[model samples]
Target chain A: MADPQGSNTRHQAYFRANLTLIGILLVIWAFVAFGCGIFLAPWLNQWRLPGTGYPLGFWFAQQGAIYVFVILIFVYVILMNRIDRRYGVDEKD
Target chain B: MTVQGWTFLIVGLSFTLYIAIAIITRARSTRDFYVAAKEVHPVANGMATAADWMSAASFIGMAGIISFLGADGAVYLMGWTGGYVLLALLLAPYLRKFGRFTVPDFIGDRYEARTARLVAVVCAIFISFTYVSGQMRGVGIVFSRFLEVDIALGVVIGMALVFFYAVLGGMKGITYTQVAQYCVLIFAFLVPAIFLSLMFADTALPQLGLGRLGDDGQSLLQRLDGLSTELGFGAYTEYGGSLINIAAITAALMLGTAGLPHVIIRFYTVRKVRDARSSAGWALLFIAILYTTAPAIAVFSRTNLLESVPETAYVESPEWLKTWEDVGLIAWDDRNGDGIITYAPGAAFAGKPIYAKDPETNEPLRGEFGQRLITNDSAGDHNELYVDRDIMVLANPEIAGLPDWVTALVAAGGLAAALSTAAGLLLVISSAVSHDLLKGAIMPNISEKRELLAARIAAGGAVVIAGLIGIWPPDYVAAIVAFAFGLAASSFFPAIVMGIFSTRMNGPGAISGMIAGIVFTTAYIIWFKFYDPSSNTPENWWFGISPEGIGVIGMLINFGVAIPVAALTRAPSPAIRTLVQDIRVPGDT
Candidate 1:
């Protein structure tokens, strides 16, 4: 059975931690996808990666951002798993 | 063997592999049919999801669009991939924790309303159909090229294959088959891109090769941009459309991707909520292999096109171009005996006008879609060529002179991508009809056997409808998929998001919000797509809001309406609020 009272301190802490982590990761997503990819593409284009010869923004748009997104998801997974374990909400054996 | 023979052999072998997998993993129960017994390994499920998510548009059409549309094509790159961010952060793990067989099931349980479930089923079916139509058409196009059959016949063959797996094994068979499909499609897509990259840029990696300097001391992008400007087109490397439109379209596609019932269902198939999170990551990595590679392929192919196809030598054009041209994709008005082909954007009357004369001047102008009426010696008469954009990816290997076996492999790859997505979508539509609609609403006591029967039958119906759509494809098969994404974004995305995050949200709010979003987005898309196709241009669009991006506006409207409506209505019961809490936490059970 579950606790009748909702919003326990543990629940609140877990929620806050989860939201904070999500907020941070999403900000990173916005930065890479919209910032480097679109808004700053022109400014970044002035600088090219040495061997690749791609403008910074264009590379971010085409490739860099995707790599970041994959990394971000994994980070979220690791972080959440930790928080889940801390709060005793993780999958039990 | 001939290229056609190679294609037949490769496509035949792929289908046989999928069928064999289907036989091995037959579904015995509804759970097995719907969620593959909830036993798929995260990495394997990730691979399957990548195949399931990448439809014909991803395989056959994305590179073509990127080639023609240039830098603006990043909307697809970011939009299709970025949605996984939202999937990972906001939706996937929570939904997996809820542990449902379908997306609508989640909505049904969360909202605890029959009406909400029904509306969700409707949205799922609608989105899936629009999605599957584009895929079936993609299958037909590939078939028409590879099999030397009519487009309709190609679609039928694709349909038969989809029906075979989806109806028999449901998710159980389709999951394993999709894993096979991911391998086939990726290999098919990479070979040509890699070969072209090596030949032109002296780089082995196509992604890096795209950014490398061509042998001519000019970056491929620089050369493509220069050629585009000279040809009166937008630069390939710059944002061609309004920034707002680009952002909006990308956001809509991303949200729509997250909202897609078929994609969301993939998360539910994993063993644990944690796998759901990791699987989405793996899926993105799998997809990135193709997504990142597509832009490079686009630039490579476009560069090849401008260099290889000489307007004058077009009649004796390379075997690949001739083959594509034979398929009615390339057309020419050889008014002069020069045998050259020209495709200028506007008003280059090469030699004569037949029927399509200038409205005011009565002088014949040249264009493929509209024919001219008068015969006149025009200066630009020497060359007029029409190459269909859809053929760009297919013809890239041939254009770059890759071996015939590579081209044959491409056909197999395109089919695998299309068939995998088509099957995934068909299952979603069938489950929406069978599990959500028939059993949930219309017949609650329906046995598992009866429900499975309904599921199979509904899938057959869905395949037939999708085949019909393929036979009579929309004006642009690729763009039509945006409508599906847009619909998902506008309706399902909001409903599911609010249902999970907003505890106070009531059924009426959810239902009304979805209805409003659907109506607004659907009306906008229909108005622009069919009723006023010309008005789809940005100049006339409201705030430069093309129908593709209107989903963002629709989603906002949904949030706006639902929040206010929920505030005004009675708050949900404590039990319902607790359920929301249960979902928000990782281990609900």
Candidate 2:
């Protein structure tokens, strides 16, 4: 338990940072999957995608949401990696 | 070569590759057997995880279901892929950091209770068993259709192949073979899709082709919507199901995907916590390649099918319809005595077509139009055809008049998807029994060598049982799939999330929460699905959530019970709190 006080505070800060990032990402996730894909689909269907015939909401549900999900995970990976290093808690290997 | 010859050659060669990989990468120790000695590259592991996660349902059933349901099918597309987001963000990295051989290992140790471990083992085994039986049956179906063999014989052959690799090489064998399987399956799926896209929309990419306009100045989807309504069905782009049900079912599937023991166990094969996150990203990317294309195929195939079948003379209908009809997946009943086929939005028969057969010769009876004669009465509708949803993907190439080899490739791809998922589930079941139940409890003093032997025996036993179930498959395979996802969501997802995220969640709380969740969801499913299926209508549903979506409520109940119980009870020991904290960070231990 060397310097338990300082390390505990640092760990707390790191955990809070993680929670905030996760919170923001989850909000975006819910918005795309539930918000645009389902609830607002009818409203968004008023407009078609530019040059393509797909309604915006239908595209999100069928194709766009999945693309966003993939990008979201990769974004998480990159940001989490930076956070890991910033906290000096990254894997040492 | 003919389609049959091509199927045999390709499927045979794929099996040979898998066996060779298994022999080369066979496990030599418990670590290798359980986690591939934690040596798998993230990309390779990603491919394997994708192969393991995408079953015959995703490969064969999804596109067909989407073709039939149209926009309503977005539930599966979003539900299945969206789960990876939850897994990567919430569960995968932390579980990998804990360095466990199995999901039960983490649950039992984290809760510091044998009962908690036992509950986890039971949930894992039950879920995996239910899921694997379906995969084996899928393999058997592919063989029976393409290879012209008995379904039981196909299952036996599949069992023998799986037993060799799973029992001999364990996770190490399954992982590498799955990488090869992923390649084979994706290739098989994409080739026909690309060909169809070019023929229909002048685009090689099916995803873009779905949205492009045809010569008629209407997109494929617009034409589909028009055709569907003209045939008395809902528009193709409009979701037909209740919105609440769709949202709830999607939630259940997403949470269930993250909680699946077979899927989560794949993460343990990676070397570090970061690898877990990165591999999940890769896995979803690989899966998205097929998933995104499946809906495109659905739209294209549905448009093609509607355009070709309805109003066509039976004698002159495309050869694919007759081919599928010969196999009993397509049925034509000239309900109005008209020579032309008329499809609409109603059941062609009360259930499956009861084909009229020659009693003496025991062969199917044929009508004047050379269509198979059926004994069943029509449902007073103009619909003359009863089409099984599976033909969308299976017969897409044939419908589009693509080469016979493309059709053959679909068969091999279905088999790869089924076998890979089956192998992954069997491993989880075996590890739960041999590792958690036996080594962790019944025989704690057992040596690693004996443990490894026990695991192999358990896997062998699991394969045989799964094969038997596949041969004499229950009529409720589709219904039981709902049970697997529902139980996994209700029982494992909440418990595991609480165990990792909540420092105060104790053994009593977890055990009670799991029991409550599983019982509530199982009873609800049984009540609606088995006990009184006629009452399964939306009007009778509790809050309009179907049995498929009841897992969402069960999860809420789990959280409701767990947090309160944990609050009233004593806090977890300091060591456990520290353990939770340790898993949250990616650092050298």
Candidate 3:
């Protein structure tokens, strides 16, 4: 095991990186799910999809947000995995 | 074959598959019973989680509810699915790394108090039972309508089937059966959707079909808006409620989803922390297949119902209408006495449709148009037909003139959805009782074999109680579902989040926060939902946030109370701080 002092500093850096990543992703998460989907839905409704002619906000609320949620989780997985490796905390293969 | 015959065969085969899988993978020890021996691959666990999480409400009720609500339905569509993001990022991996069998185990250990564990145990059991009863009722509803059986008998049959696999296999049996159920339900949900999409939108994908123009030269949603407005209902795509309520309700549901014991327990079945993260993604992917399609189904069914039922002679109404009417879920009053159905915006009669019964044979009294006669007076609205929101999904196949087997498949799918969720909830309830309550507190020295037996007994007993609740459900059952989510949101979500992210969170602070959260949320819900339902409207609400959304405030109360309380009180021990740090990283360091 590494010395306690160095390990503690490494741990702090790792956690801060993880926290920063989470904060950024969550902002995007909130933006799509709450912002485009609900709050600004009426404003977005002024625009329609190119071919199908569905209101942009309506589509996001009912369909787009859900698709984005799935993507967000997978993105977190990928980024968190890389961070884990950088911090020497990824699950041993 | 007749719908009933096909329903019996398909539902029978599904049950047989579940039982066979259960017997093969039956739990042999406590670990197997609680966490499927932690060997389930992420994809398989994902499918199981999908089925377990999407209860009968999502399968049978969601589209119907959405059809009625129009754009406002996004609250449920977004609320339910968005929670997975919270689960993956804020909770699941860390919980899996903690490696406990039940949610209470984590809460109990993290807070370092028996009271905290007991509180969690109560919330887990309370929330699960509240939700499970609704699933049982869904099973009974599907059974009565499709299989031509009594609702009580349907609940009993559903109970018996769940009992076999759940008691025999525990989490192991439940996990595999849920995967099978996910397949059945998704296939059943998709076939009719694809057929309808093809017929209406000329697109094979329901998601795309929803956006495209129909034969009427309007997008399906536009057409729905026009049709609803013509009939005096609000336009289909406009939401009239306050935005704050919508946001609050969505937040409540999302946090509640992350907090649920049954859902949290699913992560523990995965082998590694990363598996928990990815499996959540997979679960949402599977769920989205249905969720994205449901709005399409909602539009198709609503448009079909409006075109076929209204402005038509009662005698010429489609076969599904008559069929559903016989089950008393659909009714017409002929208020204008024109022999024509008028399905406008208002209730046809006051209260539910109470069929006039023949005292001797117990058959419904019929009107001149051969419609089931009702005893209630007019609701004074122009509407003549009473359509239950549930029929939007249940009778969609028949409404669209699909073959009888397709209808039967829908029945089987609804049963699978209900039974899968019921089995999952029962496992959570049983594990809480046997693992957390009994072994952890009452008898720490109990043998693994005896604990396994206890788990089985707990599950079996829970099934009977759930069935009883289904058969003679209390008036508060529906109200309690809202409470379940709110309670989970206000109680478990804050406590667990704090326990993981905030190392300074001590037993006293967490305990007080939990109590404050649950008490505040509960009192608000009970006051509005039960005690003073007359004042449940927005104007009477606190800051225009409905009781359905009050849990958001309760969650804030938890956070607001917890941090200060923790700062004032002694911090957690250094070892406990290390535990928090350990769970954050996936590998040993």
Candidate 4:
């Protein structure tokens, strides 16, 4: 009696959107921590960055990832807020 | 007073202050106990959260790990701090709007099913216990090393302090105490770091200090790279290992941090949903201060260590090195007969006397500086140096030859960092047992007074258990803590996220997904962590992923099982759907 099928479809859409955003973020996060930190490190080492004599990957592995993480938090906050509003679930106090 | 005596006195006073604060701010009711009456200011909560989150590992273990791992160690710096972004963006505000005191409450209520709540409780308990054990162990190590007390006694002292505050005041007591602890610990950590940086690079800020070129015109990293390469090791700044493994471990750590129970619970303490969002931003800012300094500490300490031992003779070794070696930290073998310490690569001294030979005399270097510093090498193995990674941060001030008080400050700072985290974890575990298990499940109709009593009893009991575990830790403190984070990421993160965002997620789906995730990940960890080593064959790891990286695969499985099973299950009743809508809207209160 509660339109179970209809609710199921709606829920699927929401799940897809949440998963998509999470997937995108995960890819970028991996690229910074793993890609730049380890795999691409050798390649990046060929090109020394300004000021710091080390490769970009070395910097990414240590300082760059942390800096990106702070920015990511702000980004996640904005994106999730938008998702919540679009889904009509934004808290209106 | 002697330097050690002064360290003991100052650190002891800080503990007394923490207890006094806890006693003055003891919670009055269940609401106050659980969420600090939801009256904490955003900035205040931010500071408390920062203190709560930056555990002993961050304060002491992180720099040491980085120093040893070289480039690979950045995974922790990125992974642990990155979770705050996930917290700020994905989970915090919605959970605050749902307005529950515990994470289990949100999961159970969101799915409108008791089973979902129970499953969440199990996950919370597992994660909290694993996490708390490491924190307690950290406390004991700091106490024994700095205060010169027996390890067991140190654990007991730490246990008693945490029990008094966590049981008496709950979140209210924990919150205020954390603020105090943060101030003490951060000041203790930064002062020595600043001094060391200035000494090394003439820069007060560690972040800039590390990048500043040394007096030789080569960057500090460039110098380190040359030193390690000369010693037959990878350059300090170069990365090694498979890309996939790095990605998996980093992802696992970040997700695990985001899903951590103690951190998520802090969101419920703020007054408004908006405040939760803002507090997260502030928490990250506070955390970044230390997060950024850690790498600098790693580079500076590694450089200093190499310089101190630079191809010198055993007799010429620095005083600090000798002291640390006496404490069983640094070890070296005089491979050749020459009294001069030869730190060169390969077995250049094979079949030769204990010390390397002098080029001119072709005889053992002898006399005061020439004696074999480390005498016990029966097998004559080539790798003759042993240095514990933990000593890097512990001996940083001493290594730099800073004043004695700076070293004392580090001792106190380490304790504060460890105790604050242990207290937070103990409180989380006790609350979950009392609020979720006893009150929510077994005694739903119990009075608030009884619940409060139960919570106190639970907190006391947890402290004892954690202290015992601390006395005899199963693994090194950092490895054990990393396993806990991996478990949280694989099991809890998916469930919490899906339950909040997806209306189709049924009780059965959430529970099964969690069970599957926990079972698969736990099995992988046990097999690789314990079983595989006994056989001595090629490690039968799944998909070439080590136990450390298995959490990423486990997380995928959790999402896979949860989404499909959720799709197969019938949707919730209309009443349940309305509850979801209500949770989404913040004004229901």
Candidate 5:
């Protein structure tokens, strides 16, 4: 079983790293979706986008946020694949 | 040929294509039936998943909602796509590594409790059934309108198509068929949208067209906002709902999207865990294509309705305007007897609108809303046009003066969206019954052949029930659908997340957390949705949380109950502990 105590410690460290990674991403998500999209939308609307006439908050809620969500998923995929390899758990294929 | 003949030809051809694909890829084993033998390419599965996920609501209903709801409609766009971030990160990869054919398989195995599994099963069936009923209803409506047949016959035709694909080829059949469906639907959606975008804004792309100034030198959205406020409705570009309601509603939809069994099951069809991760990105990319273009369609169609139909005397209205008016879907009262239709806010005018005329009776039928929906008010007639929201997508081509073929394509596209979702959902329901209920709980030693047989039978039975619900659609079907999303968010999401993330969560915690979430959320929905639907406004809401957002609270209560209950309970057994570690890693024997 590859030394129970040693593997257990290794597993805990891997788990903690994952949690930290996920925690950071989730905070970013909550900020863009809730903090910016809703609460700050009206306030941000005061400043019109330089090129686009849309208010900053309106832009964020409608288009900016979805683009960011896509970026976030890509980021997660790239980062987690790295993490998986580092932890020796990457997919075979 | 005529428009009706063209529509019949296109829709008929599309159904034939779907049926042929289903037969070509029929599933042999239980694995083939349930998870497509886990052999689908990530990108292809991504397309199939997109078709399955968009549903009639996304295709037929969303633009309609946006036409009326204005800025509030952004919630669906963000809510639907944003959920994929959660899914790709939180659930998909890990579930794929677990290598289960069904969601209940994961819950049952993870918690090491039959009851926990059963709860997940019940929630899966309930949510999928509610969702599928809406899809069936969508198909019936689309077919009936297109073919000019009885709605019930349309439903039967829809049911027969689903039975051949879903019950015959299972996931394998459904998968290939959905890829074809995605092509049909996206093409249908984009064509009318692109044409209108060019006509109005002169932009080639609908996405850019939405923000660009038209020939009149005003942005489409700006003009729409101006038009909306002039009629006393909220501004189109401005956010509509309260901040808290928007926050909660968006969160509920995101979490619910992530939790949906039909969507999650799609991940399992991919060959590797990595495919599961990347498939979500692709799925979102595909869905976002339609979702982003939808608002533009809404903006264009609403603006068109305002410009072309009105001002012209009813007798001189455009051909497309008369077409819808003939179907009793659009009505405006000429209260001033000027013979011109002036639509304004409902409360602005005292004139009541009546259905133009009953074809059979050659007399005006009572308007569907039955209150002279347009009323005899010339005072400030608030766009008193009773434009049925469902007609937005269906009628878009006609309104835009597009070719008849494009209109026919939209008809086929709507059918594709509804059929794909119905098939995906029926698969979930059947697996829940055959795999979870009969085999997992009742007959543990059932043969594989028998299980496969039971699955087909279960699927057929579910179609009948779902079709019946579609035919006699419940009074509050749409609201109940939102409630289904609520049920999913409150129950499966928390349970599955807890099981995977927390090694400390015992079966007891999982059980209690799910029960608490389901019971609380359901009671609130029942109270608001059934007991007193009239008082479902924010004031009557608990803490001003509307029923649409109540699931967020239910999710929190689940966490609240789970953490405490788990802390007090015995730790998960050592075997279960190792199972979690095993499930986390991919490419492990």
Candidate 6:
């Protein structure tokens, strides 16, 4: 029944960290999808990639963005687990 | 058996199997009904989630959208799948550890306010209904084309199937059935894609085959670009829209996927937080099988379609064109009675080319009567050939002259995909009404038995409404569904993340944020989607973001509003803080 004010501070820190990670991830996601896929597509098109006729940006927009997304999920899981443990809120069976 | 009989038998059998499974696995208790007694295996849960997430839109509409959009179609493939990564990393496991039956339960409990839960209920209903309407419409469209049934009758049949299991068996039943659906849908999607790839590129793997250019030794994309350019359309691989718009739309689709309630609720069905995390990874893997192949399906189908009918006169068009036309999918009009098909850009076809004269003697300029098959009728005259984008995937096997059974299988798969998602969304709506609204808000002391009854009633009622919408869908099923994503991202995602991770996000702040976000996003969509003049123009957009991309902006506003409000508001009670801490630490539970 003790006041959980101190724990609230800990929770707040965890929340902040999670939000920061989400923000970073979101920015990178936008960069890949919008930057490589659309905005920079013309610039990236100058360098011809081997095998495929598509420019680098076109590949990233269609295929690379998805690959990056899969990697991001794994990164989130690893980071969040550490965050959970650090906050002493790790789930136990 | 004939293709039609085979399709009916296979699809009917799958439906029968689904009902049998639902009956056998009907939940015995309220918890069992709502969250599968929280015992779903990570892999199984992942498969079920894939089925739940891939609706009629994914199966029927997505590839078609990609076919017309060309290289840009990658947006759907990447955006939809990438959201799972966001879900896995940013949301799922922690939410599961928070241990709630529905998404609103977590919001209400975390914020320590019934009002927050109610706000969540509104967002949930709005998002689910928008998404469900599209699925119902997809079902009707697919049935009308393949089964030759009336669209309204098709929607009713789909509604009845969803209502039967969703009301009777609840989450436990839905989870198991979805796993079966995932298998059926993936098989249905891949078999045709692979067959078409083989026909087009001599490679059975659709992904690699798509890269192979046709027999002229040109890359597939190069050939497609040439064909499209020849046909008076934009290049297949070229960018079309403003960079900002593309970026915004992609972001909206990704964030919206992360925000969807039905998707988030599936994670709660697992036994532990770890399972939720693992389940998301597995779900992405399952989804990737079809997601990766979808682009290839688009490429191969497009290549085959063009090659089969390019420059051919109406009388000489391929058999598949006539077949698809009978289904009202492909249409053509020979505006001029030129015995040959002419495909070229509008400007190139202004007048008859002086082909009768020698090239060395004749100038490039020509008279009004060109040898071109198309006329520049100022009204954006119809092309002699018109193909509905939705048919790209569904009609792919038939287009490539694959075996009859493969075509039938694709039909069954589309139904499975549509039905699974419809069931999942229906459950969300019903649970929100019965559990959150009835038991939690209106009748706090209601018995479990009474609550279950209410849940069933809600599920049945939702199916009927969704079916009605499906039969007579609004003109903007895709746009409305996009709006649903915006609402989910704006309202639920921010509140849930804050509630779990931020102890200071009190009831008042969370509730206010949810209300603000939902209201703003909904109003924005309504205004632009329904009210605004020149509604489709990007210039008419708010802050240069189209209605499609506004969801991401709305999410930021929700977080912006909620965090500051929480700082100014009084802290939550000690008891509520303890509950928050308790939910975060599974060992304490």
For model 3, residues B197-316, the per-residue Cα lDDT tens digits are 988788999999888966666788788778889888887776756778888898899999999999999999999999999999999999999999999998888888877788999999
Query: What docking tier does model 1 reach?
Result: medium
Question: For model 5 chain B, where is the 10-residue window of minimal lDDT?
Answer: B368-377
Comparing candidate 2 with candidate 5, which one achieves the higher DockQ? Answer: 2
Q: In lDDT terms, how accurate is model 3?
A: 0.91
Candidate ranking (lDDT, best to worst): 2, 3, 5, 1, 6, 4
Interface RMSD of each: 1.8, 1.2, 1.0, 3.9, 2.0, 3.1
Chain B TM-score, structure 5: 0.94
Scored by DockQ, the top model is 3
For candidate 6 chain B, which ten residues in a row score worst on lDDT? B347-356
**Tens-digit per-residue lDDT, B16-115, candidate 5:** 8998999899999999999999999988998999999999989998998888787777778788888898998889988998888899999999999999
Please, what are the lDDT tens digits per residue for candidate 2 over residues A1-93?
577788778888988898899899999999999989988887888888888888888999999999999999999999999999998889988
Fnat per predicted structure, each in turn: 0.65, 0.75, 0.78, 0.59, 0.47, 0.48
Q: Model 2's DockQ?
A: 0.78
Over 4 Å off, model 5: A1-7, B214-217, B309-312, B335-338, B347-383
Off by over 4 Å in 2: none
User: By DockQ, highest first, what's the ranking?
Assistant: 3, 2, 1, 5, 6, 4
For model 3, the docking class works out as high
**Can you rank all candidates by TM-score, best first?**
2, 3, 5, 1, 6, 4
Give lDDT tens digits, candidate 1, residues B1-589. Answer: 9888989989999999999999999888889989999999999999999999998888888898888778888899999999998998999988988887899898888888988888888889878888889888888888887788988999998888888888899999999999999999999999888898888778879888877865566677777777777666666787777888888988998999999999999999999988999999999999999999999988888877766664545545567665664455665555554556555554334322334457799654644333222343455533355556678888887888777789999999999999999999999998998999989889999999999999889989999999998899766655666688888998889998898888999988998899899899989888888888877777788778899899999999999999999999989889998788888887643
Better of 1 and 4 by DockQ: 1
| DockQ for all models | 0.65, 0.78, 0.81, 0.38, 0.56, 0.40
For each candidate, give its TM-score against the true structure.
0.92, 0.99, 0.98, 0.88, 0.94, 0.89
- Evaluate residue B432 in candidate 2 and report its C-alpha lDDT on the 0 to 100 scale: 90
List the pairs of residues colliding in candidate 2: none
The CA lDDT at B143 in model 3 is: 91
lDDT tens digits, residues B389-491, model 6?
Answer: 7878877777777777887888889999999999999999999999999988999999999998989899999999999999888777766876888887788
Please identify which of the two predictions, 1 or 6, would achieve the higher DockQ against the true structure: 1
Stretches > 4 Å off in candidate 1: A1-7, B214-217, B310-319, B334-340, B346-383, B474-480
